[model samples]
Target: MNNKKIMIYGAYGYTGELIAREAVARGLRPILAGRNSKKLQPLAEELGLPAMAVELGASETLERTLRDMDVVIHCAGPFSTTAEPMMRACIEAGTHYQDITGEMEVYRSAHAMHKEARDAGVVLCPGTGFDVIPTDCLAAALHKAIPTATHLTLGFDSDSGLSPGTAKTSIESLGVGGAIRRQGKIEIVGHGELTRTIDFGRGDKFAVAIPWGDVATAYYSTEIPNIEVYIPMSPRRAKKMQRMNRFRWLLGKPWVQNWLKGKVDQKVRGPSEEKRSEQKTWVWGEIRNDRRGERRIGRVVTANGYDVTVHGSLAVAEFLLDYGGDGGYFTPSKLCGYELVEKLPGSGSIKVGID
Candidate 1:
């Protein structure tokens, strides 16, 4: 009975289910929504929350649903495909759109709608989860520390694995190589083309550049002309990732994607409660302007990605409700402020220092 008409689309997925349970714990009754009622209704019934089932392919159904929602915490993915329609529907209905997407493509595309969202008086923000929240905030904090920063590098290593939806996104992108921002433009490069030693506040780890969402969001948050983000990968895995470039065509096919999805569905159920409690997620970022001879560094530690997603998603929804801001396209840092990462329920600590 929170009286906030928030809807959790894809609420039956792994992270979505977690968000729904935690939303109830926090006294917000979110509608359990997704593409299937057979799956959604049970969880909705168990949680005593209302439920809705609608296909994104059905424009009328999607539009009708959007008209009823005040805000949507879109848990569906790979959002690269689902987002455009949903975003348009939300804008048309004047409903705030928030999603847990970390896809660099999604962020770039969403950023293009700043004016429309502002005109519609609705907030359109994605990367509400670990995908870029910690790193994006770190980038913003470092930017605030050194406004002249011309280059930014962000990285993270988490003691956890992907959920099914996350794994599917990863599989889809396996053929897409990697990307980095250079002079404010996104540049695509070979997979594992860039590797560096990063100190994620814990210790040194070999991290390789991947198409993380921060590559897009950090640029907007900091106005930095160059940005790259990484995650720890062992030598063998790095080599395997590089090898994937030669087979991009095969890996990107729909049937092959489905086959890999089958593998992921079999193996990835995400971490359990005990594992989530035991895990630690770390993010590191550096801001530098060689011409100005300045350097700033920031690091953060947080809970498992999924846990942070649960808390971060709801936290954002709460912010839109309480902060009462004019709507526009926003990065996590822009919408919630740089302290959002540190203020998040499960995010551990943040440290910024001059280097």
Candidate 2:
């Protein structure tokens, strides 16, 4: 393990707590950090870890505080607002950075920072969560099988509720038009532009294209030119999404977004501990070369999606410690490959192979 001290920034959030617990279990002593020292104090005490209370907007102070830490597992979400400062601070502090974001904009911005990260000699990686770990690696594996692949399609279904952080992020993404990779470039597409019934080894389920992070990361990892990502949705919710696209302008309104955010605040907190243990996350991916009519499919079913995020993020952070390479932006598979998924605890419960 990299022996450098680890800091779990936003460690008071739902996902941050999970990462902190797992980090401690792995015999790591992480410094829990977030905006609320009072909250961080109790959690850090319970875990026997130190705590730091630093707001993301405090750049100089944030950089100074992070100077002693070797890497930071950033957990605060709605990453459009939270990610950039932390990333900048990490680069300035020469501390490696990782986060569990599935936001395409954030992924694209991070990818664009590759040169800066390399110059700073610090690895900058995002989507260490369930977002791209299984999907990105599946794309990488398929690309390895068919190196000439020209197009890719990915789908996922999770029998779990969204965390508060995820809910907020989802709301933030609602107004943005859908995205797909076309000719190796990110392109805007109408919501529900591509819908398909994918047989994920269990049964046929309806999936609709949504701007998933894989649209960005898979291309970086596999070089597949055309890509579409789908998520399982019921008929009503699917139709609602499509219909609302016509009124998407309303979603971006400050007042409208604020109202929705208020409602989200009223909702129950993230999944219960019981639900986290019982739910399963199923992901399906396929790559193909239309010219050659060649194709490959892969499936992964892991413990709970949230649990996988916690473990997967920690695994990536730990791996970066011992990694000896010029630091730059990377997808999970590009950095570590399928071996990461294979080694993660509870990932043994995951199933991945050709269809």
Best by lDDT: 1
lDDT of 1: 0.87
User: Could you tell me every candidate's TM-score relative to the true structure?
Assistant: 0.97, 0.95
Screening candidate 2 with a backbone cut-off below 3 angstroms (N, C-alpha, C), the clashing residue pairs are: none
Model 1, span 1-355: residue lDDT tens:
2566899999988899999999999888888889999999889989999998899888877888788778899998879899988898899888899999878888878889989999889999998998778888889989988899889999888889887878887887777778899998999888988999988877888889988888889999989999998899998899988888999889888899889989987888887899899988888888899898988888888888888888899999988866577878999999989899898866766788873
lDDT string for model 2 (136-184, tens) is 8777777777889898998878888878777877787677778899997
What's model 1's TM-score? 0.97
Candidate 2, which ten residues in sequence have the lowest lDDT sum?
Answer: 345-354
List, in order, the clash count of every candidate structure: 0, 0
lDDT of each: 0.87, 0.84
RMSD of 1: 1.4
C-alpha root-mean-square deviation, candidate 2: 1.7
Worst 10 residues of 1 by lDDT: 346-355
